[model samples]
Target: MMTKSDDEFLDDIFGTAKAQPTLVPDDLMARVMADAQSALVKPDGAPKQSLFAGVFDIIGGWPSVGGLAMAGVAGLWFGVSPPAALSTWTAELIGVPVSVDLFGDTTAYFAETQIDG
Candidate 1:
């Protein structure tokens, strides 16, 4: 079930199951040994926590709940107020007065100009 050509091809790829020797320069070898010693010198062998965890810890320990209170006030204002409330607020902000009455017929305070060429 084995072919000679396949066996030779496998041997060419895997180097006939023999380990090849490696060569290293004396100066480069000394430098590599020094670097390995430095890499192994951990203070207590504990893994350092990432910067993301530190940021999350600070945000989680924030002292104020002002944001939550503001959100609740905003929700209450939007839910209980009428749609006309926003328009009246805008008019008041721009120094204009607006009146709304069911019994009174509404009229434009100013006349519209008809442009004729």
Candidate 2:
């Protein structure tokens, strides 16, 4: 069992106390308010940046823009020229002369093999 004086002692030792007042001088408050008011009143006569300038800034800042451009050019060149070269190279590697007749003249060779009775 605890005594009343012990409880009172604990309260006096560990209880929450009221905080002291924080003081702000009048001159500092006036200066801060004046600065804020000046920032709020910007001059509309200032020159604005163009949309093109903004886009250029973004594209120029991107680290991978040059890499992307190079990849695009390489992709376009490969797209236009690779499949035909690959087919020709494959045919040559397999020991056959690869001939492509795009206007359908190669079908004449097939007509010569007629049906026999």
Best lDDT among the predictions, by candidate number: 2
lDDT of 2 by residue, 34-82 (tens): 9998788557955787997778677774665777889999989877877
Off by over 4 Å in 2: 1-46, 57-61, 76-117
Q: What is the lDDT of candidate 2?
A: 0.76
Give each model's whole-structure lDDT: 0.72, 0.76
Model 1, 1-117: lDDT tens digits are 779999989888798556677679899999999999888868788687789767656666343355667878898987787478776887788968657686453333322223321
List ranges where model 1 is wrong by over 4 Å: 16-19, 42-117
Residue pairs in steric clash, candidate 2? none
lDDT for model 1: 0.72
TM-score of candidate 2 on Cα atoms, chains taken together: 0.30
